[model samples]
Target: MQDRNVYTIQQLSAFSGLTVRTLRHYDDLGLLPARERNSSGHRLYSRSDLLRLQQIMFYRELDVPLSEIAEIVDDPDFSLTEALERHRKRIGAEISRLQKLIATIDTTLHTVNQETMSDRTNEELLYDGFSKEQIEEINAEVDLTYDPAIVAESRKRAKVMTKKEIEAFKIESSDILNGLIAAFRRGAAADSEETLKWIGRHVDTINRFYTPTPEIISGLGDLYVQDPRFTEYYDKHVDGLAAYVRKGMKAYAESMRT
Candidate 1:
């Protein structure tokens, strides 16, 4: 039978699969103090210490900051069972977020590939599942410059779409973005005939879906590079794709009589 009392740092590291350096750092951070030292002066962990480390790791999985987690796990009133329940619920939320994000990527890729869509507005297609406040913040950053009429219509259209329709649209967009990234990797020039064609399609789709005035699309093009959120959204689909899309949109919009 295994002993349940004292454990050398190595034994604790093995059991927890945590690096010795990490444990030492945690000790330095006062998240976990060495329970005792052996006769030769090496650090030793106790059953209590190991259990505490497990609690810390559990919080980390939920993206809780280390400092906050230390305070939480070390609190006498903090219930381990309650913590586990919270963790389970938080995990479910994270999974839901990931699922929505994947769908958004897919829809973006699809729209990029098709090169055409109606003027109902698909700009906020990726905004599903976000809290209302978060959605407002996102729109304020990117969609605020859009035509109010187009924005309202887009919102209405989004509300009417079935869940399956949204999911299908997301996957389609993801495919287009992945393809663009691949082409970009192969040295396709952003303004090259083929590449510009894809970018042009993207602009057209947004205009068609959002019914954004030419000026609205042009304004968005200008903001693409200046706004990190827009840049990151495009970049996530493909490296350096954001700047290229911005350029393409600018060129297409400039061609229009805004």
Candidate 2:
């Protein structure tokens, strides 16, 4: 007779939405080892295993590597309560971000409908999420970092672009970012061809604003990490994303130099 307190592998899979093969892989990695086996050698998972699986899934959703997840969950002093608290905080931040985006969409829709015409220009609408103060801060930093002519030219180029062109530009930038995130999640090295390909696309995106030399590209990578605003913007999408982008950009710049 099966233990009432334990579940078979199939039962666990159906409950967790994970494949049987994935469960087997986790067992093989000793990440979520089965409590025991039945008389026929089928794996049986206890309630403890279910709780551990939940932790694994949460970490995975946060882009944590499976190996690191194992080390973390298997740590002698690992605290489920603490981990849950951290997850709650991160989820709250994500919800706030989404709410801001929703507000932006609503504003844009209202302007488009002509029921409430906005005094703000289309170029200003491009930066919907950022406040006027934040935009000024970012512009001030850019002015200090780059040549005045270059900064002016970039702004002029952006101001002259049509609304459709601006939307297309944003879509392309988003696609490149998503590609880079996917590569980072897959454990691709900074200098790997897959990573560099995305970085190359990023360079093309930058060219739409202003031409960038290898030195400029590498310098921009440094800025991404050094500037808190840029770092927060990227890392909000994926933990460690800004650092990963910096490494990839540096590698790409080095390849261009050679």
Candidate 3:
């Protein structure tokens, strides 16, 4: 006859959705000790053991630390009803937090879509993420470095670029600067084919916002090395990046002459 109120380790695993190894670990920890060992010396669990496994899973669902759960469950005065009520309250708070988060996400998405549909200029859309101080700094940088007429003209041109084009321009700009730094690290000559390729990308980026002549490109190269702000911008990425890129752009400008 089959043993009453008993389950083998495998049987308990299939019923409890827990691995035999985990059950064995729980047994070793005195968390879920087996009721008996059968003829083959395999663990056998009683009905009471199955109830304890249910309580363990419930505690786990509430994120109770295993050690704390063990202590609480083993305590003589432990009340399952009290634990369930506490878990319910905590779960309610978590649900409220998640609901608020979802509402916030929905509101932000609606605002972004509305702003996009309102046809804000590319410059507005592009600088949407920047703070007022950062936007002022960028405008100051452009005005300080370029002629007033050129600065005004560049802003007009920037308004025409689509969001995708603006994003591509930013990505290409970063890629060129990073490529120049990498080339410098490898001891590549500023006029080398690969280095010139990066310089070409840099000029293309400039030409997108404002059409730059060879003279303009050459002059800008000097400014990149001389201007502390520009130098800091490039040198932040690599020790001598501003000088390296200045040299590379000068080579490219000379090549344009021929």
lDDT by candidate, in order shown: 0.73, 0.88, 0.81
Task: Give the candidate number with the greatest lDDT.
Answer: 2
Tens digits of per-residue lDDT, candidate 1, 1-258, equal: 435688988888999988787789888889999977877998888887987898888876544557898889878898878877887898888798889888878887888898654555777775655668776787686455655777688778788889887787777676667666776767777656666666655665564366655576567777877776667677644436777766666666666663
* Clashes, model 2: 0
What global local distance difference test value does model 3 have? 0.81
lDDT of 2 by residue, 1-258 (tens): 656889999999999988898899899989999989988999999998999999999997776667999999999999999999999999997788677778888777877786555456754664566656767987798777898888888989999999999999999999999998899989999889999999999999899989998899999999998887778778766658899999999999999889
Q: Is candidate 2 or candidate 3 better by lDDT?
A: 2
Tens-place lDDT digits, model 3, residues 100-217:
6676566557667776445455324443433466568877876776778777788899988899998988888878877888899899998999999999988887877787878888
Off by over 4 Å in 1: 1-6, 14-18, 60-67, 129-131, 135-258
Model 1's alpha-carbon lDDT is 0.73
Each model's backbone clash number = 21, 0, 0
Pairs with steric clashes in candidate 2: none
Off by over 4 Å in 3: 1-144
TM-score of each candidate structure, all chains considered together: 0.46, 0.54, 0.46
Error of 3 at 113 (Å): 11
